[model samples]
Each structure stands twice: as C-alpha cells, then as structure tokens.
Target: MKSYKDLSKEELLQLQAALEAEYEDAKSKGLNLDMSRGKPAASQFDMEMDIMDVLNSSSDYKTAAGMDCRNYGLVDGIPEAKKLMADMMGVANADNVIVCGNASLSIMYDTISRSMTHGVLGSTPWCKLGKVKFLCPAPGYDRHFSVTEHFGIEMITVPMTPQGPDMDIVEKLVSEDEAVKGIWCVPKYSNPQGYSYSEETVKRFAALKPAAKDFRIFWDNAYVVHHLYEEKQDHILDILAECEKAGNPHIVYEFCSTSKVSFAGAGIAAIASSKENLDDMRKSMTMQTIGYDKINQLRHVRYFKDFDGIEAHMKKHAQIIRPKFEAVLKVLECELSGLEIAQWTEPKGGYFISFEALNGCAKKIVAKCKEAGVVLTGAGATFPYGKDPGDSNIRLAPTFPTPEELRAATDLFVLCVKLVSVEMLLAQQA
Candidate 1:
C-alpha cells in the first residue's frame, strides 16, 4: 500500500471520496461498539466466578492470624492480606504495603488529596503553595492526568521512550522547579504504550534530588502482573527497593489492585511505600473511616494465597485477553502497515495499543470512527487536561470487546484513519 502523502492531490481527493462513501455505508449499518476504556469483557469474568466461592457462607470469616474479618478493626488491612499484596508487588516486607478498598485508583486519589490538604510528611500543603505541577508523560494514563488536573495542578507533558518516560527531562524539571511536586508513572506494562522502565531509568528516578522536598512519584503498577506473552514478558525494577537503596525511601508511593485480575470494581487494592509514608497516610486514614472492608481483604488473601496463585490466575487472564489484543493488532497490521501516515505501539502485556495517526488527523479520525458506529477514547485523553498537542495519539482498548467486535470496530477504525489521512493530505495540497 502506497503512503498517502506520496499520492498526487487528485489521487488523494479520489481516495478520500471512496473512503467517505465506505464510511457512510458503515454508519448505515448502525454498528455500535465501544473501545474506550480498559475494561475486561464479560467472557473474561468466567474464570473469576470461583472468587465468589472463596467466601461462601460455609467458609471461615476469620483471618489466618485469627482476626475476625466480620467486625472491622484492622484499619491497615488484615495481616494476611498485607502479605499477599506485598508479595504481588515484590516487596519483601508486608509492613510497607497497606491494603485498601476495591480500587487502587481510590487509594491514589486519597493520597493526592491528603498531600493537597496536609502535605507530605510536614512539607507545606500543596493548596498553600503558589503553584503545583506534575510531570505527565504523554501517551500516559488519562485517569492519572485527571487526578492531577482535578487538584488544579499544572501538568507538563514529557515524551515517552521505549524504555520509559524521558527521565533526563524528568530529572531536570524536578531539580530546577520547586513547583514540580510530583510525576505520574505507570512503571510496568504502562497504560497505552506498555513500555516498562529500564533498570537505569528506575535508578535515575530513585536517585533524583527534587527541588521540592515533598516531591513524590505516583507509581501506578496497575498492570505489573498482566502479561500477554510468556516469552516477551517485561520486568520492571521494584521502585520501593530502589528508592530505599538510594536513601530516598519516602520519594515513591506505588499502587496496585486486582481490578483487572479478578473483578473490575470489587477486587482488593494496595499502596506500597516507606513505613514513614504509610504512617503519615495512616493518621489521615484514622479520620477517614472506621476501617476499609476487611472481609473483602480476607477474601482476596484466601483466594490468591500467594504470588504463585496470582500468577496462575493472571495466566488465565492472559489466555483470554491475548486473543483480543491479537485481533485488533492483526487488523492494524494488515490495513495500516507501510502507510507512513500513522504509527502504533505493539504492546506485549498492557490493556491498550497506542496508535499515533498523522499530526492533526487524530480528532477527525476519532470523530469519523464514532460517526461510523465505533467509539474510541476521545483523541486527547491519553494526555494531560484532555489535550494532545499534536492531536496524534489515540489509545485503543481491546480488552473490553470480544474478538469479533474488536475486528469489526478496528476495520472501521482503519477505514476512518484512511479517510481522515486522505482528507488531511488533500487539504495540505490545496
């Protein structure tokens, strides 16, 4: 297939007309499909049905340490659950991990709120500061950006490399600007791109001497255990360990949850950090509520006894989601390869395949896809404040759609991309 930019203006116009006709026909079919969020499909839940059985009426409601889970008292989660979560995060000590409610996103939000109001370990509260900024790697998770934006924090877009965020930029920004309070990172199998940080990148992050004393790395290892290829599995350095080794133990707060592992909204979540960080958060937690859902915490521990069990369960998830990823990738490969009008990331494990269309064509392609009955994540969501400067990156979430649905949606998606690219080319020619 010839790259659209190489075509003559007449040829581009002719191609755009044909693509428009095809798009209209696709619209007439009224095919409503959503590839918006990184949610697991209905079929993917079948394996998790046994999770319900793990805590039936016949089961013991007490923890292995004999703490009755029926009554709430462990504000930091039950001991067994802490250990299980720590194991998941590769932390040698469970004392550093605080198991929380169903979603790690909630844990992350609360941490940010706490910092905004109370500050991190006695630094000036961000609310009192004149300005607070966060370094957001472009093609990053939207929710992370949303949280920072919600707090009225300025977000600086840092470009991402295959190994991770451009750390050289990250280091310099944090070092020079006291206003740069923190950065949002998805260290392993990152959102959209699925690129894990290289060992050196992790080391640099650990050794960063931020201008702001309160600066912290909001590390969301949401897909740490999510692997699509056994052979191509990505390994990321343990952030907490690296920080501790670098004598910056309080510089990072890492989060993970079983939201994707077992159930979307009902799985257990956790935060791993230094004991001092946990202690500071605990003071606020005491005021937040009597306790989080300890029963559910015990349920997760009882179900996935250790890292091995969790690994086994995730392998099952891999078996299910791997094909959906492949289905979408296959369509992208066959339709857009060598087009030179676009580029996309072929992720090995994460929930999305990040596609970069021709500059200025992303929003139009997304609109065209929506008109043709396929809904994508809005073009700029992967960036801070819902703005993609070049209007290029588009996140494709394949996990939520069935193989057949994904194929059809992707077919329309590529068609829209072609249509939009041709139109864009024609406009440039004019």
Candidate 2:
C-alpha cells in the first residue's frame, strides 16, 4: 500500500526480494502469453462467423446499381461500401471515399509514398524537395511514424495532451514552416492512450493557414467506432466538415476500416478526402491496379449492411473484449494504486491502455515481463522510431488474450513494475 518512493533502502530490498521470488515462480509455471498487438480474440471472430456465409456460390455478385463485383470496374470502391465507409468516417459525401484493401496502414503508406514521388495536389514531390518534415504526436501510433520515416521525411515530435496534441505548438509549426507538410492524428479512441480530440482542437486544425499549400492532416480514425462502453463513448468533431467550413476543403485525409469490425486481415479499408485530393489519388490508383477486391467489398457491404449494422457489430466486440479491459484495470488498481511509481490511462473505449512507469523503468519492466514468459508491445513502440525519450511508456493490449490469460499477463506486469520500481529506488539510495 506504500508508495515505492517512500520506502527505505532496506524495505525496498525486501520488497524486491519478494517480487523476484514471485517472478521466479511465475516463470516456472511456463506461462507463455502474448499481448503484443491489439488483435481480436478467437471468440470475437467466432461471433462474426456468419459473415463468411453472407455470400456463397449460389449468391448474386451484382451491386444494387448492377455493377458486377466479379468484374474489374469500380476502381475506387463499390457505392454501398463507400457510403458505409463515408458514414463511418463522418464524411458527408460518399464521392470523397475510396475503399482500399483490408489494411488502412497500407493506404497510409501509399499516401506517404505518393507524396514522396508525386507530391500532394501538384506540389513538388517530397523527394525532390531540399527538406520535408511531418509533425508526430508522441505516445502516438508507431506505424504512422514508420510511414513518414520510410519516405526520408523529417519528423518533429509534438507533445500529446488529453484533448489532443498540444495545439499551440501544432499551429505554430504548421503556420511557420512550409516543410511541415502533415500531422498524424488518431482523433477518436487514439492508439495507446484512447484520447479523443476536442472540438476546439479540431477547429484549430481546420482553421490553420499553413505555410505550405499542400499541408495536410493525415487523420487515422481507426477506432472511430471502437468503443468499450457504449454509453460512455467519445465523439470527435468531423475534421473534413470542419475543414470545409473553414475554407480548407483539401486539408485532411480521413481513414477507417472494418479490420476490427470483421476479420482483422480480411476486412475493408477506406480513405475520405476532398474531391480534388480523391481525384489526384484516383489517377495513381488507376495505374496501381485495376481495382481492389470488389468482391470482398461487396461481401462487407452485405455482411454489415449499413452503418447501424456496423455499430451493432462493434457493440458485440465490446461485449467480448470489455471484460478483458476491466480485468487489466482491476488488477492494476488493486496492485498499483497509491504506489506513486506509476500512472496509467483508463480508456472508456479502444483496444489499448497506456501505462506510464517510473522514469527509466519501462524497458526493464517490459524485459522482466518477457523473461517471465509474457510478451508485451515493446517499450517506446508508441513513439516515432520506437524511442520513448523518457523510457517510461508501455502500451498494454487487452483484446488479444482471453480473460484468464489477460489477468495472468497483467499480474506478471504489475509484479515486474513493483520489482523494477524497487530496484530503481534502491539504486538512488546508493
């Protein structure tokens, strides 16, 4: 019950010994559990098994408009799928949506790659420019950072507040630097933290007058419909709408997918942007391939049927995974509460809970957890280039494991936190 910081060297040593003994016992149990990614559990998939039967050999493959899904037309996406994705992304116009393959991350990668070679809306290609930069919100999504880094674009770290990335810094960076081309945002139920952007922040983003004409906000609204508590959901302002209202029609690209809503690897992904931006992307997409899997898109539209159906499906997801989240939170509260050595977020929705350990303690805690046969997303993975400057943040994924496995993993996690905290404190005493 005592804060680790208040413990004497002798008490810290004693506590460390007890936690180490517990660790050894845990290790001997051969508990090989992995919580490295926010993957849907088998049960979640089982619940949606009916999706496989939505289409069959006997079923018709024609769209409502009579477009044959078996053919190579509809380069962007099927009309029904676009409407669904557009509604999911809060984009008013279905014409602005381009449904892609299952991975939104891939679309994001192509966006960056296209910008590097062809540039945004006719600006000089990023590769040809002397310098290019992106604003990276820290304790943010690593894959977003990876895309920017891959293109050899410079990334500047922007601090994250609960409401969103610190907007003053964002506004300044965007306005003064032409090289600051874009910012990555999760907006709703953000990665790791599950923090949503406030209306004011969204307004500021839309209203910004950037130095570069091509500046953009890459809005990765992956968890827009992923809420753990149906009653306590976080709703963010529609960035695309706000941008248009602010006279910045082409300032954002919003992305969403049914990766979690249906099968993780085999669901539909989409991007919604201004007509001009969509047109530019269509030019490249025309050459990239004839089209994405139209049959698969048709399958999704048939399976979920509409935005309401998708919402109903996600509620089922929450029903299955919410307990896992609560289990982790209960253990954390029971074991680590008042232990001043750590802090963590209690997200109402989203796949992850962000854990902030004592300074210099995250890597060691993660290492200890892994040694005891429990795998976690590596420390610092939430940041750009996989570096958490303070070495203090770790992302806890509760969706992948069963409730029993999650409890065990979280138990070992807290044990490691206590043991590591004690060791850090003892070192300071010396």
Candidate 3:
C-alpha cells in the first residue's frame, strides 16, 4: 500500500474518483449513525439491568452508619459510599472523599463556580481579578474546556505529547503567571487520545511552583478502571499522594464516577483532595443543603460492595465496548494505514479514538461524513475555545454504536478523509 503523499497526480485522481463513488453509494444507504459522543451503548446498559433490582421494597433503607437514607443528614456522603469511592480512587482514608451527584462533571463545575465567586481556600476571587486563565492541553475533554470558558476565564492551549502535556512549557507558564490558576488533566486514559501520563509527567505536575497561591490541578480521572484488558492495564502514581510527597498537599483535586460502571445518570460520583482542601470545600457545601441523595449513595455502596466489586463490573463493560472500538480501528487500519494524509491513535483503554487529518481538513472531513449520514465530534472540539489551532484533530466515539454500525460509519469516515485530502492537494497544485 502506498502512502497518499507518495501518489502522483494521476494516481491521486484515480483514488479520489473511486472514493467519491463509494461515498455516493454510502449516502444512498441513508444511514443515520452517530459516532459523536462517548456514551455507553444500550447493550452495555441493558447488561446492568440487575442494578435496578439491587434495591427494592424488600430492602432496608439504612446506611452502615445507621442513618436513614430516606431522610437527608449526611452532608458529604454515607459512610459505606465514601469507603467505596475512596478505594476506587486509591485513597487510603474515606474521610478525604466527598461522594456527590450522579456525574463527576457537576461536582467539577461547582468547584470552579465556587472558586470563581469565592476564591479557593480564601485566595482572591477569580471574577474579581483582571485576568484569569487555565491551561488546557490540546486533544483533551471538551467539557473541561467549556467549564473554564463559561466562567469567562482565558484558556491557553498546551501541546499534549505522548507522555503528557509538554511539561517544560507548563512549568514555565504556570510558575511565572499568577493569573494562570488551574490546569485540566485526564491523567489516565485521556479523552479522545487515551494517552496516560507518564510517571515523570505526574511528578512534574506534583512539583510545580505556580505563581498563584490558589492554583489547583483539576485531575478528572474518569476512566481509572475503564480498561479494555485487565492483564494489560496501565497505571500512574496517585496524584493526591504524589502531591503530598511533593509538599504541595492542597495542589490537586481528583474526581471519579461510576457513570460507565452502572447506569449513566444513576451512578455515584466523588471528589478526593487533601484535608485542607476538603475542609475549605465544606464551607460552601454546608450552606448549599443539608446533604445530597444519601439513598442513592447507599444504593451504590450496597450494589458494588467494594473495589473488587467495581473491578468485576468493569470487566463486563470492557467486553461490550471492546468490539466496537476494534471495529473502528480495523477499518481505519485497513483503509488509511500508511496514508500520509492523516494519522490516528490506538488506545488501550477509554471511549474514543483521536484522528488527525491533514491540517485544515478536519472540519471538511467531518462535514463530508455528515453528508454521507455519519455524525462526528465537531473538528475543533478537543481544544480550548473549541478551536484546534491546526484544525486537524477529530474525536471518534465508537462506544455507543454496535460493531456493524461502527464499521459502516468508519468506512464512510475514511471516504470523507480521502475526498477532502484530494481536494486540498489538488487546490494546492492548481
């Protein structure tokens, strides 16, 4: 197979014609497949139907601490739930965790909101400052960027190398700019790319000397246990512990949830931080309400007994999602390998595949895919301000679709890539 860049003008024209015919045939099928969001497939949700039955009229409504879950009392979380979430996050003390609502994203948003209005640990409020900024590593989560953007904070894009964000730049920018208050990190099985941070990268984060005293690292560990294979799992040093060892005890805030483990909207979420940080967060939390859904928290604790229980459940999720991921990868490899027109990442775990088309071609490719009846994540969504500087990266979420659907969708995706690249090259030649 020849690389697309190696093709002569005539050869490129022939390939483009063939791909256009295939694209037309695909459009005629009138498919309505969406590979846009990293949502759990319906089949994966169906497999966990037993979770709905875990609690029933026959069940006791009391937590391990003897608090009636039916009433609101525990401001943080039920005792058993704290233990479960703590163990899942690799934290030794359950006291360090705060189990929140169904999604960790909500907790994350609230944390930023609180900080913007009231300041982190009594530092100056972000809204009061003339300039506030966050470091967003490119090809990262869109939601993370949106949270910061919503707060009217400036988002600076950082290039993400395979190991992690280019730490040399991170070190320089963060240490010198007091306005740069936080950074968003996926750490393990990162969004879109699935590139876990190396040990060195984690240490660098732990050892940073930020110019702002209130600077915090928002570590969203959403895929801590979402591996495709148990035997081939990847691990990173716990950021909480690493920060403690680095003497930056309150520098990191970690988050996780069972959105993929159980039901998406019905699972428990949590946040882990140092003692001081938790103490500080409690100030706003106490005023917000007496407590959250302790009944739901208790339900989660009872269903997924411990860390081992969570691990066992994740194995089941892996079985359902792995085939869909492979289906997309297989098509990309078969059709686009050695094609200099694009490149992509093969992740060991996570919900997405990151595809990079020729510079300035991603939006066109995505638009073309949509025209053929397959929807993709907007081209620049993986970067800050929803702007990929090079306009190249596209996140392919194969989790929600079935294997056959994934294959068909990815085939159409490759056709669009080829079509767009040929047009790009031909325009340059003309």
| Model 1 quality (TM-score) | 0.98
| Candidate 3: segments with Cα more than 4 A from true spot | none
Candidate 2 per-residue C-alpha lDDT over 1-430 given as tens digits, one digit per residue, 9 for 90 to 100: 8888888878888888898888899999888999999899999999999988999999999999999999989999999999999998888889989999999999999998899889999989988999999999989988898888888888899999999999999999999999999999999888889899999999999999999998989999999999999889999998989999999999999988889999999999999999999999999999998999999999999988889999998999999988998899999999999999889999988889999998999999999999999999999889888889999999999999888888889989999999898888898889
Candidate 1 structure quality by residue, lDDT tens digits, 1-430:
8877788988887887888888888889889899999999897788788878888887889877788888969999999989988988888889999988999999999999999999999999999999999999988999999999999999999999999999889999999999999999998888999888999999999999999999999999999899998889999888899999999999999999999998998999999999999999999999998789998887787788888999999988999999888888888889999889888888889898999999999999999888778899999999998989999999999998888888889999999989888888888877
| lDDT of each residue in 1-430, candidate 3, tens digit only | 7877777888888888988888889899998999899999999989888877878988999976678898878888988999999999888789999988899999999999999999998898889999999999989999999999998999999999889899999999999999999999998889989999999999999999999999999999999999998788889888988998999989999999999888898899999999889988899999987898887887788788889999999999999988888888888888888878888998989898899999999999999989889999998999998888888999999999888888888888988998999888877766
Clashing pairs in 3: none
How big is the positional error of residue 345 in model 1, measured in Å on the Cα after superposition? 0.5
Q: What is the Cα-based TM-score of model 2? A: 0.99
Worst 10 residues of 1 by lDDT: 43-52
| Model 1 ranges with Cα > 4 A deviation | none
Find the 10 residues in a row with the least total lDDT in model 2: 2-11
What's the CA error at residue 221 for candidate 3, in Å? 0.3
Query: Quick one: how many clashes does candidate 1 have?
Result: 0
